[model samples]
Target: MGGLTTAAILSDLGRKVCVLEQHYTAGGFTHSYERAGYEWDVGVHYIGEVGAATRTRKMFDYLSNGQLEWAPMADEYDRFYVGDKVFNAVAGKDEFRNNLIRQFPNETQAIDLYMRLLDRTGDALSAFGMGRGMSKLQRFAMKPWTAWKLRGAFRRITYDVLSDLTDDQDLIATLCGQWGDMGMPPRRSPFMAHAMIARHYLYGGYYPVGGSWRMAETIIPKIQAAGGEVFTYAKVEKILVENGRVAGVEMKDGHRIRCDCIISSAGVDNTFSHLLPEDVAIKSGYRQRLTSVTPSMAHLGVYIGLKGTAEELGLPKTNFWIYPGNNYDKAVDAFMDNPDAPFPVVYISFPSAKDPDYENRHPGTATIEIVAPAPYERFEKWREETWGKRGDDYEALKEALGSRLMETLYDKLPHLRGKVDYYEVSTPLSTNWFGGYQRGELYGLEHSQQRLKQDWLRPKTTIPGLWLTGQDVLTAGVTGAMMAGLITTMSMVGARKMGPLLRRIYA
Candidate 1:
């Protein structure tokens, strides 16, 4: 999306542009597919920082030529199901905190602290995102400021945040209603990353109108209007190099497209290790550090084409985050040893939940997805086939897991049992294929304080004229990736001028 969004922006700024995608469609995870009259979003659980005057909202409006509209999640924004206790994650910050406090009246002080953390974290990010992408000297000067703000915020991870926020293990789990956004358990995730999403939902999460696909589609025309092109099935084989700098890109069919520069949202390793020459790789130390870095988390998703809207089935529009009552972190480990292990953590969302008009998009149909942490190794046996193409073992495994997952969903909302009309399962293997992720890795780089704090991963690479973008730089998600586009575009233009452009972006 960073690549596409930036292409749209620059192309609009009058630079010729072309997008190279490995897949047949645009919008990596945001891409959706139609199956038996129902469509499902591969990602996009919920979007934040999209309110009026918000950074994400401004960027989207700018890139989409001002045609995009954001749809707030229906009433009761999000619901957390910790065992049988239900907590409503409302939209406004004070309202949200009050909701949590209402449930756990005794821990009012803890709620107060959590609210402060969310507010403070938002202050830092707003400063960082909209206040000029700091220059080298300014960045150096700002390091202490950044460090001071993040001292406790990013150091301990979200797990520690939840743990500190509430001693009630169940509520601790409940507060982490959307950990799936970052694949890793909160224990390893940077608190800033967690807080951003916490802040997004606190405004109450919203979705894009006309499907999440509209994000790319909206910007696409602007790229053309800027005299550029976005085409499906156009695959980039290698980033063309000239004098140790990016010259253009060579397609799989051996066609060369020339450009003055190359910006890649393909990811860190793929851009550096696969596209650009390794010998001239920028920041060898940074590359070495990433080699030792851990991936955030991958997901095993089940897509169901339900027979009716969630409302008709008596389901809540708000998502249901279900997790095992205890021994939470072990669930990820259990998957590596056993693919068939009972998934302790799962999330279910009916895209049609937010809009009744969805039925107009696919009459009498709704799409719901169930997701859980998945180890890449679990699908190693089926890795041989092309991505997105599943074989026998793949189908069998999917069917089995899909059924078991259905049972789990039924346990929470029994009305869903006979509600599904069509179903399919997607594993890490599918993501590896369609998403171009290595080892079916989800969420660009893992969300760790160590990874998030490292300065090397920022856009500029050692290779001249080559740049990295997407979730690798920013934490993965709609708003973060969109910010990645803003930051990467600034780098391509030169980091020194990043400030003025950001001021304009926010202005």
Candidate 2:
């Protein structure tokens, strides 16, 4: 998304662009796959802020040239299964607040404060994002004012900030139940990130009409319309540098694409550690800088195909987030320390239920995706092995893990116990195989307080002509990456050059 969005904007400005995707398909995580007549979207389960004509929506409209459409999920878009208790995140700000108040009548004050903090995050995020792309002198000039406006929200820990509002741990867990969205638990995540995500989905959740791939499908044309092109399987093996500046990229197939300017949406780790020359990376301080941040949590995905339709299977449009208990941080720590311990979080999404055009795409079939965090270390032994050919040991482990996750689904929706026709498990290695994440991290870089504080994680790197964009540059999510692309374009072309483009996108 970040790459595609940036290409569209640059192309519109009459600058020819080319997007090289390492994956066989475009759209990165947004891509969907078909198996046995069933199709499922990988990363984009549900998106927020696109149901209406908000800034986020308008950007999507402009990028897809109004070809992209959204289908609203249930009013109760998110369903939480925390232990035995069930909670619903209803749509609409008032409805969400009222629902929460009803759930915790005694914590009205804390809930109100939480809502206020989410509102305040708007200013904090703007300041923080602006700081990322600004030059040293520009940032220094804006530092004091931005700090005063943000009020340290960007530095504080999410759990610490929320715990101050209430003693009830269950409420805190419920509020941060979507922690997996950012690939970090609240105890370690930045409060600003939490607020951004909370406010993003306050209205409701939306699914792209047709499928998530429609996003790239629609936007790619804009790039092509301006004489730019996106190429899949264009594996860039290294970023060529000469005289301490980017020269071009060397492909794995021994081909070279030489250009003075290079925009890498491949991700920070890959760009610095894998792609850039070892000496250049060290001399540029990126090698040392990487030590401060860690990869986000990797996950195990259980994709199930059912013989019946989503309606027949009674799959709700609302996403299901199941946790062992309200103490999310504790649960996550336990699972991280011991893999056998219950999953810290099990997020279930019925893509077939969310997308209105699913029936037309794959009639008489339903697909369910269950995602749970899994350490990359567990799959480390198979790191050198080929994907889909990792042998019996890998297959056994996957089946065992997939079966456990399947039980969770049957536990919630019992009627569909014997309805599953086929299922497959994707470990962290699968993420690496498909998405090129070295550690198979679902989110590029961790959203921990330390990672979020890194000022170097921006579009303009120290290396001239080598730019960065994607989840690592800003927050994580489809919209977040899209915005990162926007800021990256501004940083590259300057505000004066991008002013008209910005006005048109927002207009």
Candidate 3:
């Protein structure tokens, strides 16, 4: 998403851009795959603010040339299952607040306060992005103003801030039910990160019509229209540096693509540890800075194919986020310490139910995706093995994990227990094999308070002609990565050069 969005925007600005994906297909996480006559999306489950003419929606329209379309999820877009209790997030600001109040009637004041904080966070995030795009001198001049604007919840940990607002632990847990979206529990995540996610889906949720890959399919034409191309199987083996600056990238096929500017959306760890020369990274202080942030938790995904229409199979347009109990942080801790413990969170999405165009593409089939955090250490033994040829032991482990996750699904929707025709399990190693993330980090770098506070996690790099874009540059999620691409372009082209493009997109 970051690479394609950047390519599309820069191409529109009349700059020839080339996006290279190591995988056989484009669209990093947005890419969908076919297996056993069923299609499933890898990452994108649902996005928000695309149902209307919001900035996110406008950017989608501009990038896809208005070819890409969206289908809104049910008004109760997200359903939270905390133990045996049920709660949901409804569409519209008033509806959302009222629904929460309906659930926890006595905590109306806290929910109202939470809504106000979300509003403030919108302004603070804009400032944060602006700060990242600004020059060093520009930032230095606005330090005091920036600090003031970002005060309060933006700087605090999510749990600390929420606890202060209310003593209801269940309310805190319910509010932080979507913590998996950011790959962190409330105790560990920053309030700003939480607010960005909460505000993003405040209005509603939307899915790309057809499939998530349509995003890349539609946007790639814009890049090609401006004399740029997106190439698959074009893996960058190393980033070439000369005299303390980037010159180009060396491909795995021993070919080199020389360019004055190179934007790496592969990730920070990949750029510094694997791509750049060790000496260059050490001298530039990047290697040292990398030590401060840790990789996000890897995850396991179960893709199931059923031989019936979504309605026939009783699939819900509402996403189900199942938790072991209300104490999410403790649940995470227990699972981290003991792998056999209950999963901290299990997120299930019914793609066919949410996408109106699914049945047109696949006449008599429906797909369900289940995602939950998995420690990469469990799969590290098979890291060096081939993708499909991993070994019987590895396959056995996947099967065991898949069966356990399937039980979660059966427990919730028991009617479809025997209806599933096919199912496959993907471990953290699958992420590394497909996405080129060495550690299988789901969200690039973790979104902890320390991680969010790092100034180096921006588009501009100390090395000239080199830039960063992706979830690492901003936060996580499709919109977050897309915004990172926009900010990176703004930093690369300068505000003056971006003025017309900004007007055109927002117009």
Query: In model 3, what lDDT does residue 251 have?
Result: 98
Candidate 2 C-alpha lDDT tens digits along 208-238: 9999999999999989998889999999999
Candidate 1 RMSD computed on C-alpha atoms after optimal superposition onto the true structure: 2.5
- Clash number for each model: 5, 0, 0
Model 2 stretches astray by more than 4 angstroms:
none
CA error at residue 405 for candidate 2, angstroms: 0.1
- Measured against the true structure, the TM-scores of the candidates, in listed sequence, are 0.93, 0.99, 0.99
TM-score of decoy 3: 0.99
Local lDDT at 2 for model 3: 90
Least well predicted 10-residue stretch by lDDT in candidate 2: 146-155
Across 223-282, the per-residue lDDT of candidate 3 in tens digits comes to 999999999989999999998789999999999999878999999999999899999999
Which pairs of residues clash in candidate 2, taking residues 3 or more apart in a chain or in different chains? none
Decoy 2 TM-score against native: 0.99
- lDDT sort, best first: 3, 2, 1
TM-score of decoy 1: 0.93
For candidate 1, the per-residue lDDT at 62 reads 79
